[model samples]
Target: MTPGIPGFRHARLPGADGVQLSTAIGGSGSPVVLLHGFPQTHLMWRHVAARLATEHTVICPDLRGYGASDKPAATSPDVYAKRAMAADVVSLVAALGHDRFALVGHDRGALVAFRAGLDHPETVTHLGVLDVVPTLDMWNVLHGVSAAVGYHLFLMAQPPGLPETMIANSADVFFGSFLDAWACDPAAIPDGVRAAYLRASAAAVPSIVADYRASAGIDVAHDQADFDAGSQFAMPVTVVQQDWGAQLGYDAAQVWRAWAPDLDHRLTRAGHFMAEEAPDEIAEAIRELLAR
Candidate 1:
């Protein structure tokens, strides 16, 4: 069986819009739900959650269409939109009996956490995002280095059939590339974790592609509408990212400031997978956000 967060118990919880979310529940006290990023599962939160479990009820759920979560057939491009994914998270927390909670997400999960904070401002008390900006800001800032480094976003954004077929034919190499290239300390993602990610991703190619496709199309529209409406997250927010904005010639904090008025943005020395590469820092950031 797959190893998991040491003290947590697993469950397949019914989620928003008929998605079944694979979740890990543990701890007691104020609730904190953690969402994982691309090419990974809730297992990505293993190290971080273990530490937080001592003081908070930590709930980690695989975003629908990832890991053991049910990947429903896409009825439309918007089906995998972060708004829908965010709803799944909100519902999972409610089912567990928490009316409101702090939320932390890494990568794509951060997008969902962002949407959750925006769409349900009263429910998400504090939001922490790791390694990403808002979806609209991400696309808006892309040019030169940002475009080059983020080529996968465009690749997966293509019309469905092509990206799925190509990625599936060389699944291991495609998925492993992210795990290998994004980590500054390769030891942070050991063989076992890497293997699990590869296995899960390879088997869910289409759904994964659809998830990214939504970002390029419907997700941007949703974010744009929110942007035009002058809506911003009211809850306290913390963001830690690799200095992609500085490297890519954009101001990361400046871009994030528009979405989060009460924002604490920092650059990380750790690579893209900061939770594993620097669990103490991520855990402490969540704790500090919760304390706020």
Candidate 2:
């Protein structure tokens, strides 16, 4: 059996367009939703969610097309677009009786949360993003040798069939590679959790590829339009990330500032999987963001 956040109860909550999100909800008081990143499920937030649940209602959901969530076919570009995923989040929260909540995400989920803050500013009281810039800015900054770090992004961004076939043929290796490489401490993800992540990701290859493909296409268009409109996040926002800019040749905080004016951008020594690798730091940063 898959392990879950200990005190959290699981549910299949309605998301946008009849999609159902596999959600783990716990605690009480003000609501806060945590979205997990690529190649991983909501389980990644297990540590952080437990910490936050002591004072806040913490909701962790496998985004549409991921983990136990409904994997709707990506018949259209918008299907897996962060905009759509963001909508799923909004609808899911509303279904859980929250009109507004603090929204936080890691990696791909951060993209969705970023979009949510832009599209649903009135509904998100606070925003937290981990380890990623917006899609447009991400594409803008990656170039030459530095771009090598994001090879999977390029591979999965391809036009469907090839990427899906390649990954599915070697699913465990493909999924496990990220879990192994991105964690600063391998022990941070216990053997069981690592197995679960690989299992879930391997089963969702097609939808996962579609998600990345959307980021390369429609997601970028949406982000570009927002940037053109000077749309910025209108909530207390906190971003925790490694000093990726130092390695990739761009100012990470400055890149984020373009989209978030009320931003508290932080540099963490933790790995890409910071929530798992350094839960206390992540939880404390989230608490600080909530306080603001």
Candidate 3:
């Protein structure tokens, strides 16, 4: 079934004190905040949110550097840190007058949700992470073809000058590659969305690189510290991933269980962008969990 999301309205919600995040809110009921991945805005949640809005209010936001948001200078990881991004979620909810809400995230958004779950479990009633693992587990599993499957991870993690220059030169090809590679149905991405992603990525090359660079550097440290402390997401977390590590001798749920004590993990046949590839299932998963 296809979801019909006509359009979205914008708001710059008060977030993390002085920081205001650009957000898109629609419908009404118990709130569900949807955070999207790299090279995508709140639009990624458009289709899913449309279906979700039938029963619940949905909030979709361009996390910091992605879309119609305040692209602040990320001089340090503390500022651009996933933890900081998580704080944006917490404050955004409060600004919208919701004390607690269900949170859903895809790709980079999933990483942000991971941080939010650990840092502010009280604010999130349910956590659904789509298409990515915890930072440290991902680092550990980046072996063999898994590393090759994510070559961009290493390239994007480079310092500002290099990735910025390289991707800036061929923004379409560089950014579009993931669009084709990750999605099972690339045709499902409209030209407007594709063009929008290209434009945003081109303009935010430095910050995008810094985002991944932090994942390689400080993000790693944060995840490692959590590992050393035997800490994981402190919530009823559900993980949905495209079993990428199957060929690499790994079980997705087993690995996720190590990070989420109260976990409900699902392995889907769809490609990496499960929200786009399997919206009905993803939407149902959120609906079911929210009911509980």
Candidate 4:
């Protein structure tokens, strides 16, 4: 049996363009949607979702091309673009009877949430981003030897055939490397959960690579357009991240402040996978964001 959020009921909901999203929904009252990061699924939100569900209806969905969600062929660049994925989030929420809701995401999902805030400001009431800057800024900040930390981003950004072939050849080592390297506390991901993440990621290598490849091409272009137009998020925004800027030679908060003027930028000791490594802190931060 698949491990899931304790109190949530699972469903396959329709996303944008008729794609299906595997989602876990629970709780009641005002709604909040949580989007998972790469190499994991809706299951990443189990701890944080349970806590938020106590007061707010929490919706957790496996983004298209990840987890049990439909992995449509990346026939075109836009298919895996963050713009399209953000549309999926909007559609998924509307399908669940929510016209507007608080939106939070980690890693790749955070990229989608950032775009959603800019593109559909009227729909996302509050925005919470964990452990990543916007895509445009992300690409700009990485340079020289420090960029080695993000080598996978470059590898997967290559044209379709080679990346898919290389990653699929040793999917476990590729996916597990991130899970192991990013977690400050290794025990945060138990054996069962780790196995589940590996299984899901191994099966979705092609789509996952497509998702990253879009970030390199289409995602950057979209972000560039928004930046050129001086677009900013029109809602209260909270960002929780480790102090990566210190090592990477950039001001993390300043980078986010440019995009989110009304921003509450926080630095956490937790590693890249802050949601799982520090659920209580993450949950409390979300509560505070919702209150604003």
Candidate 5:
């Protein structure tokens, strides 16, 4: 378990479609659910959740196929689609006695949170995404450098057997690459936390690849439909990301603004793992989004 994060207790809850979600619950008042990104678990929310818990009932869940959550056999990418993952979050919070709540996510979890806001606007009161753009924009904005930076997206998008087998054989290198490269301060993620993330990701290699594979296929289709319908996020939205647009030659804020009419976008020097590298900043961003 993470060192501090006061008053939080963990549990396993049933998610949508028989998947199980390992969750951490604490505090009281208005509810806020935090979701972790790839190669991490609910523990990634250690500092942010603890702070939010003081004023809000903070819930952190390991998205299905990550951490201690159930990794159902992948029949198709559809099973790991962000839509399905988003459903898991909605069902999990509802089961935990929250009909509506503010939602926050980092990295892969941010993609799921994006889907949750689009799929259940009434249920997600406010949305906060750290270090990511929407899935569709993510693909559209990619060119030379951005594509190289997000190499895993294409590596995992490859036909099933190869990516999984390749990743499984070199799990440490595959997962460790991100842990080492994606942090502004490598020391921000404690050795213990880093070890835990590596272990969990290594164990769930195939399922994790399936999750990314879905983004390239089914998840894109869903986002396209939403975009075509001109669906907009009806809630307050906050986005924090590295100046990827500057590095990648696109306007990150403009991309997010297209979907969220009410948006608060900020560029940070913090690396991809912003929640861990700058927890106070991330927590304050969520509070600001909630206050809106």
Candidate 6:
């Protein structure tokens, strides 16, 4: 195990789109793949992945376009679709010589994990989706100011160049909005950590837009395919989310129920970045889910 973060070794992963990616892996035993959300990298799972690694082999990788991954020139949201991302995880695990493993994701990562569970049900033994519902549910729930909270989704999904330029001009302000506004406790994001996210996001403008752009386009289509197929994950599943968002019309868990029949849903008081703001609680949930 790694000295401090049980799972934090840097590795390269081959993505489904023929892109080689930078990944962080640690821990030992049953393999566990950790996926990060938007504007963040694999580092988001630092704490939870570490704790899980103490018993299970934990792996956290930067999604295709976010961190040190190959930023392919793909404007068609299909290129960045959840199905493609899920394929990336499958290939990544097989690259590590595992036929199947446990899967966990937060924010955007949660969507990718959802796709993985739906598309390759045989490869995921268990799944943990944190703070998100399926893409189709999210689209229907967007109304009034709730829609404003995710304005970037529509903005970034635009024709490109413009969103990239605007985000670059105010990268810190753009990325920090969630880190600051959505935190149950603002202190969860220390200056250094906040700076790290800001720096990484600022440097990757085009890929950043592609990541969000994928949501409105191919991602939704992927989710619809699952919905049309009436697909649901057969593996044991756990969903941990903030109750406030669900109450505000997001209705996250309700959507999750349609996709995952076997799930332990827990609503908490933590903010959006539950893994960082409530590591202990998040770790407990992960541990319990993995044990099951």
Q: What lDDT score is found at residue 281 in candidate 5? A: 90
Greater lDDT among 3 and 6 belongs to 6
Give lDDT: candidate 6, residue 71.
Answer: 79
* Per-residue C-alpha lDDT of model 4 across residues 1-292, encoded as one tens digit per residue: 6798998999999899989999999999999999999888888999999999999999999999999999999999999999999999999999999999999999989998998999999999999999999999999989999899999999999987999999999999999999999999999899999999999999999999999999999999999999999999999999999966557599888899999988999989999888898999999999999999
Taking all chains together, each candidate's TM-score versus the true structure is 0.98, 0.99, 0.93, 0.99, 0.97, 0.94
List, residue by residue over 133-195, the lDDT tens digit for candidate 6.
Answer: 778888888888768988888899888789989988888898888787788887876776677
lDDT of 3 by residue, 100-182 (tens): 98898998988888888877878888999888888878878788765798888899787668877898899889888888878
Please, what are the lDDT tens digits per residue for candidate 2 over residues 1-292?
A: 8989999999999999899999999999899999999889999999999999999999999999999999999999999999999999999999989999999999999999999999998999999999998999999988999789899999989887999999999999989988888888999999999899989999999999999999999999999999999999899999998865546588888898888889999998899999999999999999999999
Provide the overall lDDT of each model, using Cα atoms, as 2-decimal numbers.
0.91, 0.94, 0.81, 0.94, 0.90, 0.83
Ranking by lDDT: 2, 4, 1, 5, 6, 3
lDDT of 4 at 246: 50
**Residues 1-292 of candidate 1: C-alpha lDDT, one tens digit per residue:** 5668898999988888878999999899999999999889999999999999999999999888899999988889768998999899888899998989999999999999999999999899999999998999998888875488889999999997899999999999999999989999999998888999999999899899999999999999999999999999999999998865445577888899998899998887899999999999989888888887
Better structure of 1 and 6 per lDDT? 1
Residue 205 Cα positional deviation in candidate 5, in Å, after optimal superposition: 0.5
lDDT (Cα, tens digit) per residue for candidate 5, span 74-104: 8976799999999999999889888999999
**CA shift of 117, model 6, Å:** 0.6
| TM-score of predicted structure 5 | 0.97
Q: Which pairs in model 5 have colliding backbones?
A: none
User: Cα miss at 11, model 2 (Å)?
Assistant: 0.5
Q: Is candidate 1 or candidate 4 better by lDDT?
A: 4
Between prediction 1 and prediction 3, the one with superior TM-score is 1
| Candidate 3: segments with Cα more than 4 A from true spot | 1-7
Lowest-sum lDDT 10-residue window in model 4: 243-252
lDDT of 6 at 84: 86
Give the 10-residue window scoring lowest on summed lDDT in candidate 3: 1-10
Clashing pairs in 1: none
The clash tally of candidate 4 reads: 0
Where is model 2 poorest over a 10-residue stretch in terms of lDDT?
243-252
